[model samples]
Target: MTDVESSPLGSERERIAAYPLAEAIPEDRLNAELAALERMDEKPLPLRIPGYFRLGGPGFMGAAATLGAGTLTAAMLSGAQFGYKTLWVSLVAMGSGIFMMLAMARFTAKGQTPVIQLQQREHGWFMAKVLTAFLGLVCVATVFNFGQVALGTELVESISAGLGVDWPREWNWPIYGLITSWVALSYGRGGRGVYYVECFMKLCLLAMLLCFAACLIVVGIDWGAALKGLFVPWLPRGAQGIDLFIASSAAAIGVMDWVFFNYAGLSKGWGPRHERLARADVYIGFALPFLLISFMVICVFAGTLHSAGDVPTTAIGLSKALVPLLGETGAKYAFLFGFLMVPLTTTVAMSIVCAIGLHEIFGWRPDVRSWRWKTCILLPQIALLGAWLPSPVLIIIVIAAMLSLTNNIVGWSFFLLLNDKKVMGENRSKSWGWNVGILVQVTMLNSVALMWVLNRMGLWG
Candidate 1:
C-alpha cells in the first residue's frame, strides 16, 4: 500500500472532520500525527500463533456484537425449523462480514476522513448521518440493544428455573436493567473501554464455543449433512423461505457490526501496516468463533428440538430444548449461562459502538471519560428502554427487519467508497475478490429485504 502521507488523494482540507479531532489539528501537527501513526505502523506484524492472538481485539468485539440474543434465537430457530440445511447461512453471513469489514478497514487505512463522514460528504446518497448517527444509535444500538435486554432477562429467568428457584418473572426487567447498566458503566476510559470489552468478549466467545462444541459432540452430529449445509444453500418450502431470508440476514454482521469493527480498529491504533492483522482478526477472532458457535447451535437444536418438533418462541425456550439431550439443569444452565453472556457482551459492545459513532458525528473528543461519555456513549440506553416495555413480537420482528435494511444501505455505500479516489487513494483500490464479495452482499442483503417487504406489501403474490 502507498504511504497515506504521500498519497495524493484528498487534500488535508478535504479530509476535515475525518476524525473527532482531525480538523482542528494544525498542519505541522498533521505531520506529527501521521508520524506517530507511522511509528505505530512500523511495528512488525505478529508472525506466530500467540502473536496473532495477542494482536486481536476488534474482531472479538465484532463477533460478540454479532452473536447477540436475537442472533442466538435466530440460529436456534433455523436449527429447530430447517435442521442443518441452513448451515450455509452462517458461512454466508461470516463471508459478508469479512467483505464489508475489508472495505471499512481499507477506508480506515487509506482515507483521512472516517467512513461515516465520507458518507455524509457524498453528494446524493446523504447516508453517513443516518447510517452512523441514526441507525447506529437508534435501529442498532437502541432498538436491537432492547432485544438484548429482553433476552438477558429471559435468560435470568431460565437460570432461575434451572436452579429450582421460582424467581418472579415480574422482576426480570428491573433486575436486568440494573445489571446491564453496571456493565455499561465499567468502560470509564477510551483505551480501557476497548481493552475491557475485548477481553470480556474473548472470554465469552471462548466459553460459548467450548460449551456448545462439547454438547454437539455429545449428540454425535451428522458430518455429511453438516458439510452439505455449509457448502449448499437450501430453504424450506413456502413461508419458511421468508424466514430463511431473515435468518440469513440476521446471521451476517450488519451495519452496526461493520461500524463497530472499524471504530474498534481505530481504537486499537491500527493503520495501513496493520491491515493484514485486521483481516486475521476478523477471520480468527470473529468469523471462526461466529461460525463455530452458530453451527453448533444449529446442530444441537436440529438434533434435539427439530427432531422433537418443538417450537421455541424465546431465548429461554431454545435453551430448554436442550434438556432431553443433556438433562434439565445441565442443558438449561449451560444454555442460560452462554445466552446471558452473548447479549451481555452485545449490550456492552454496542454501547461503545454508539459512543464511537456519536464521536464521529458530533466531533466530540474521543475520550470515554468526559461528558462525551454521557452523550456519545451512554445516551442510547434511554432509547434501549423501548425494548423493555411490552414490545409486541411484531415490533421485535420489525427492528430485525430494519437492521437488514440498514446493513444493505451501509454495505452498498461502502462498496462505492471502495472505488472513490478521494476516499481510498490510488493504491488503495479494492481487489476483484473484495468487489465480487461486496456485490454478493448487496445482492443478498438487499434482495432478501426487498422480497420480505414485497411479501408484506402483497406485491410478491
Candidate 2:
C-alpha cells in the first residue's frame, strides 16, 4: 500500500472492508469515521473548549442567573429601608459564595465527575437516591425561583404603563418561560451558545449598574456616609433589621445556584488544568453581584430613596426612586432592561438545572432531544405556572430556607468524599483548604438554620 493508503484513515477503511458484508461497523468505528469526515470538511484547529474559563469564555453565567430576581429584590428592599447598612450582607454573601463555589469548582474539576455522580459513588445507592430526591425537590423549587423573575418582569411592565408605554401582559408567564427555556436549551447545544447568553446577561447587568452609579454620582450623596454604610456593619434597632439581614444573607448564599454552578462546570468538562481560570471565573461572577447589584443599588437608594423615606418593595419601586435622580426616560429604560435580564437568565438557568437533575435522578442520558428529559423539566415548570401568581420576595425566602436546610447534606457529602482516601485519593483537599471550607460550611449552616427556624416560628418579624 502507498504511504497515504497506509495512513490511520486507510487502516480504518481496511478494517471496515474486512468485516463480513452483512455485519455492521462497530459503533466506535462508525463514530471515528464520522469524526474523521467532520475534520476533513473543516480546517485544522487547536483544541479549544468554548465557555471554558481557561479557553477564554466566561464561567459565571450560572451564578449571574442565581443573582437574578431574588437578589435584585433583596438589594432594592435592603437599600430602600436600611440604606448602606444592609450592603454588608450582600458583600458577605458574595464573599461566602465565592469561597464555596471555588471549592465546588475545584472538587468537580479534580474529581472529573458530576456532583450527583460523586455523591452516588461515595455515599452508595440508597444515599445517592436520597440525594437525588433532595435535588429533585430543589429542582421543583427552582421553577418557583424562576417564577420570581417572570412575576418581577410583569410588575415592571405594570409600572411602565404609567409612563404611557404598555408592555403586553397576555400570556406573560408562558411567554417568559418559553423564552427562558429557549435560552437554556441553547446553552445545552454547546459552548458558543452559552457564551452568547452570558454576554447578553452581562450587558443587561452592566446597564443597570451604570444607571444606578450615574444616579448616585448626580445626587452628590455623601461619599463618607455611603462608604461607612458599606464597611460598618450594624444591626438595626428593631427586630426587623435582623430579619432583613437574615433574608438578605440567605439570598446571597442561595443554595440552588451553587449546585447549578458546579454542574455547569462539569458539563463544560473543566478539570484541574483549568483551576486558575475557574477561580477567576468564580471571582468575576461573585464581583458582578457585589459591586454592581449590591453596591450600586445601595448607593442609589441610600442617596435618594432613604432620604425621602421611599422604601421600595420591588424593582419598580426602586425605579421610581431613580426617576427623580435620573429622569423618567433613563429610569424606565434601565429598570426595564435590568428586570428583563434578571428573569430571563434566571429562568434559563433553572431550566437547565431541572433538566440536569432529572437526568441524574432517572439515569436518563444527557440528550437535549430526549423527550423524557425535556418533559421531566417542562412539566414541573408548567405546574408551577398554574399554581400561583409569581411572588419574587416569597420565592427568594423559600429558596433561602430550602438551601439552608439542604446545604449541609450536599456540603457534607462533598466534604467527606473529598477527604476520603478511597474517593479522591491524591486529589484530596489540602489541609488548610479543608479546614477553611469546613469552618465556613459549618458556620453558614448553623447561622442559616437558626434564621430559618426563627422565621418559621414567626419570631424573626
Candidate 3:
C-alpha cells in the first residue's frame, strides 16, 4: 500500500504525534491520553481552605493568646524602664511578625510539612534530623513551656494576695499543670478546641487593653510624646540587662513565631488560595499584640512607672507601679489578669508546636484526638516544671537566646522551600519576596550573634 494510504491522515497523525510512540496505539486514543496528561500537568494544586474561616471563631483568639505572655513582659519592661520610648520595638516586632507569619503560612500550605520537616527534607535528612533533636533539647533545656505556666501561676498568686484571697504556693504547681494540660488536651480535638482557647485568651487580652486604656486616659499623658515614642527609634543610655530585651524583641520578629504560625496554618489547612486570608490572619494576630503592648507602655509611662526612679524589673514590680494611678485594688487585678493570661496562652501554643515537631520526626500521628500525642507533648513540660523555679525574667532571657540561635536555621529553610521548584512547582516565591525575607532573617541572626558575642566579651552590659 502507499505510505499516505497506510499511515494516519492529518487529524489522525496530529493525534498520534501526541503519544510517545505512534505505532502501538490508536491515533484518537493517543490524542485523548495526551490531552489528559496535559490537563493533569496544567491543573492547579489543591487550594488550602482559608485558615481564618477554617479556624472558625478561634483564629484571632489563638493570635491573642500567642501574643499574651511575651508581649506583656516586653511591654511592661519597656514602659517601666524606657517609658513609651521603646514602643517602636513592639511595633517593629508586630510588623515583622506579620510578614514572617505570612511566609510561614505559605510554606505550611504548600509543603504539607512543619518547618522542621521541611528543614530535614531540604537540608538532608541527617542534618534536619539532628537540628530537630537539638531544637527539642533547646525547648526542654530553656524551660520554654514550663516557664510560661510558672509565670502565670505566680501572677495568679500575686493577684489573689492583692485581692485578699490566699492561694498556697504548693497549690500553684498542680493548678498550673492542670490548666496547661487542659489547654493541650483542648487542642487534641482539632482546630475548634484550639480556637476556643484562643477566644478565651482574646477576652483576657481585651480586658487588659481596657484597663490600660483607662489608666492612660485617667493619667492625662501628652499624645505628641506618646506618638513620638511609638514612631521614633532610640536606645536608652546605660540600659542594664537590656541585651536580653533586644534579643527577645528580635526573636519575636524572627523565626519562632513564623515556625509556630506555619504549623498553625497547616493545622488549619491554609494554602495558596487562602494567601490573602493568611495575611489577614497575621494582621489580626499581630496587630492585637502590637496595640496592647504599645498601650501598655504608654499607660506605664503616662501613669505611674515613668517617674518612678527605679524601674520595675518584674511583672510584680510593674503591677505595683500601677497602684498610684489605678488605685491599689484596680492595679492589682489588672496586673494579675495580665500576668496570668500571658503565660497561659504562650505555654499552650509552644506545647502545640513542640508536639508537631515530635510528630513529624517520629511518624507519630499528631491526630490532636489521640491521648498518646497529648501525653507525649506534655511530658517534657511536666519535667521542666518540676526542675525549674518561677523566674520569668531568667526564663525569657534563655528562651530568647535559644530562639535567636535557631531563627536563621528555620528562616533559611522556609526561604529555600519557597524558592524550590519541586516543592512549589510553578508557584515559587518571587525574587523580591525572597530578597526581603532573606535580608530580614540574615540581619536578625547576625545582629543577635554580634550582640551575644559582645555580651560575652563584656563589651555590653
- lDDT winner: 1
Task: Tell me how many residue pairs clash in candidate 2.
Answer: 0
RMSD of each: 4.9, 8.4, 11.4
* TM-score computed on alpha carbons, candidate 3: 0.77
Candidates, ranked, lDDT: 1, 2, 3
List ranges where model 1 is wrong by over 4 Å. 1-47, 172-175, 188-191, 328-331, 383-388, 392-406, 453-461
Error of 1 at 38 (Å): 13
RMSD of 3: 11.4
Looking at model 1, residue 204 earns an lDDT score of 88
1-461 per-residue lDDT for model 3 (tens digits): 63223322223343223211122334454345344433543544342223333332223544544454445666666666666676676666555555556666566544444566667766876445444434633353235555566566667677677768898555666777777668766762632554566566666666666766656655667667778977888776653445644644643554445555665554443333344555655665555655665566555654566766877666556665665556644544664565566666666666665666566667564665567577666764663353245544554455545545556665566677778887766556776965585657556664664575456456777
Steric clash count of candidate 3: 4
RMSD of 1: 4.9
Model 1 clash pairs are: none
Q: Which of 1 and 2 is ahead in TM-score?
A: 1
Overall lDDT per candidate, in order of appearance: 0.68, 0.58, 0.56
User: Against the true structure, whose TM-score is highest?
Assistant: 1
Residue range 159-221, candidate 1, lDDT tens digits: 787678876545666666565565665553432554565677789898897778767766668
